[model samples]
Target: MSDIDPGQARPPRRVRVDLPGRAYDILIGAGLVDAAGSILAERLPDARLAIVTDETVAALHLDRLTASLDAAGIAHAVVTVPPGETSKSFRQLEHVVDAILAGRFERGDAVLAFGGGVVGDLAGFAAAIVRRGMRFVQMPTTLLAQVDSSVGGKTGINSPRGKNLVGAFHQPDLVLADTSVLDTLVPREFAAGYAEVVKYGLIDRPEFFDWLEWKRAPIFAGGPERAEAIAASCEAKAAVVIADEREAGERALLNLGHTFGHAIEAAVAFDPARLVHGEAVSIGMAQAHRFSARLGLCPGQDATRVEAHLKAAGLPTRLSEVPGAAIAREVLMAGIAQDKKVKRGRLTFILTRGIGRSFIAADVDAAQIDEFLAEELAG
Candidate 1:
C-alpha cells in the first residue's frame, strides 16, 4: 500500500512466499504462461513434468503452455480432469496420481497445477502423495488461484463429509500467475475470483482495503492495477504463510470468510453452476461481518462496507443468493461442524475485530452459531 500509488498505473509484479524450506516465487504477469518452459527450466532444468489441469482450462490455455514447454525442450505429460469442485475428490485424486504414474514422470519431476483452485488442490495433493512427494508448481489461470490458492501449499481432496477435509502441506516450487489468462474468464468467473482478492484487503490490511474500494474499475479492467492487486494479495498471504505455514496461528486469519464459504460450497455440493469458491467466500465474509456484529465485535457500518464491496463486485453477499435449490439449515450446520477448523469437536472461526483486524476464534459457542444460522437459512 505504501509503495504503490493507486492513481498511477504500474506494471506486472512478483512476490515471494519465503517459507523456511519451501520458499517459492510467484511471478505475476500477462504472458508468463507462454514462458512456462523457461520459468520451470530455471528452477528445475531437465525436468519431466506432469501438467495437471481440467478440461475447460485445457481447451483454452493448454496449447499455449504445451507449446511453451515444447519450445524450451521441456518434456511433459498432460492429465485433464473435469473442471469443477467435483474434481477435488478421492476418486479424481487417484486418477491423477495414476495418470502421472502411468507416464514417465518421476518423484523428482514437478507436478504443474495448470488451472484454477480445483486443479491446483487436486494436482498438488497428487504431487504430495505420489512417490511420497514431488516438486509442485502452480500455474493459476483463474483470479482465485493466482491471488490465493496458487501460492499457498494447502493441497487437498474434498470428502463427502466436508470440503478440503483431506490434503497436505506440499508447497509449490514456483507459481506462474499469468494475469492475461484472466481475460478469458467470463464476468461471473472473474467476479468470483475477485472475491479472494478483496479478502487480502479485509485481512489486516486496512489501507489495502481502502485502495480496493477506489480502484475497482482499473483492477477489473486488467492492467498495472490488476497486477498490483494480485501482488499485494500475494504479499499479504505470503506474510501470513511465513508466520504460520500450517494454520497453527496467524495463518488461520486468512480464512476470513472461508469457514462460512466452505459450508456454502459443500452444501451446494461444490457445483460451479450454482456457486463458485469466491462467490461463496463473498457470502461467507459478509456472514462473518454480520455474525461479528451480532456478537458485538464489529460495527454494523463495517459489516455494511464489507457487504457493499462484495455486492458491487457482482458477488453474492448473502446465503439466499445461492442459485441452487434451497439447502437446509441442518445440511449447512453439518458442513460447518465438519470444517477443518474444528478442534477436538469444537468449532473454530476467523472472526473479525473489524475490517483488517481478523483473528482466530476458537471454540465459538455452538448455540449462538446455530441460532444465527437458522436465520440465514430462513432467508
Candidate 2:
C-alpha cells in the first residue's frame, strides 16, 4: 500500500474496477447518496434505472435515492422487496425478473441494487437472467456488502442445498457506497459488516490491519474519515476484483472466511430467523484461524489475537455456543467439497502464515481438518 499525503485526505477519490466492457468506479464517502444522480449521469447516461431495495432500506433511504434520481432526471422505478435473507431465493429472483419485464427494462437498463448483500445478490442474479442480461449498479448499504459481496460480481441465490450455490459473475456498472448508510445499521449488524472490512487487512495487508487494530473506535464513529477508511477497504477489494472478476483463482482468496461461514449459515437453516451472515463469518474466521494454526500454516498466537479482537468487537468466535457443532462441521465440509476452489477432489484452504500472509493449502488432510474443528467445537 502506498501512502497519500495528509494534504490529500479531503480530496475526492475514486477506485476503478477493470473488466473490459463491464469496468466501473467505486465512489466511497458521505453524501454520496445525494450525488447518485450526478455519478450515474456521468457513467450511465441515457439509461432507464430500476432501484431495487428492501423494505427496511426503502423506509430509511428510498426518499433520498428517489430524490437523487429526480435530480439526475434519470427515468427510474423503485421496486421494494421484503427485508432479510429469504429475499435471496428463486422465488424472489423470479418476482424481480417479472417486475423488470413488466417495467420494460431493456438490455441496457440499469438495475441499482440498493441494500445489503442479499439485495445485491438477488437483484444481480435477476439482472443476469432477465432478458438475457441487463446492466446494474451496486449501491451497498451495509458494511459487509460494501467490503466483500457487492464488488466481486459473484451474484447468486441460496438453494436448499447451500448458500450462493446458484448465481453468475454479473459485475456492476458502478458501485456507490455512501458511508452515511452505516448510520442506520444496528450496532451488532455494524460490527458484523466490520468483520469483512478487517478481513482485507488479515488476508494481505498487515499495515492496514495494524491501523484497524489501533483505530477501531474512530472507524466506527461514522465520521468523514471513517468513510475514507471504508472507501480504502473497497479500493483494496476492487483491485483484487479487477484482476479476477469471476473468482477463477486469485479471486477465491476473498472467500477466506466464507467457506466456513456459508456452511454455518446452511447449518442454521439460512435463518435470518436467527443467524446473520457477518456473525457466521466472524465465527468462521476464528475457526479458520484455529484450523490454520493446527495445520502449522499460522502461529497459534495469531489465532489468539484474532480471537481477542473479534470477541472485543462482540463477534462470536466459536461453534460450541451455536448448538449442533458436529452437524455444522459436517455441513461445512460438505460445502467445502463443493466450493468452487476444489480441484481434482482436493480442497484448497486459504490458510494464513500469520496476520498479513496467506497461501493456498491444497493437501490439508480431512482428518486434520476434523480434529481442528472438533477442538474448536469443544473450546
Runs in model 2 with CA error above 4 Å? 1-12, 321-340
Clashing pairs in 1: 204-356
Tens-place lDDT per residue, model 2, 181-293, is 78889988999888888788878888888788787887787755676677678777877777876566787677778778877777777665456878888888887787888
**Reference-based TM-score, model 2:** 0.90
TM-score of each: 0.90, 0.90
Error of 2 at 26 (Å): 0.5
lDDT (tens digit, per residue) of candidate 1 on 1-379: 1212344323447787888977788888777777777777788997789999999999998888898888888999999999887889989998999999999688788899999989999999999999999889889999988888866688999888666789998988888888878889999989988998889888899899999999998889886788889999999988988887776788888888998898888888778789978899999999999999999999989999999999999999988888769878888888899887898988899888788888788979978988999887776
Candidate topping lDDT:
1
Pull out the clashing pairs in model 2.
none
lDDT of 1 at 314: 94
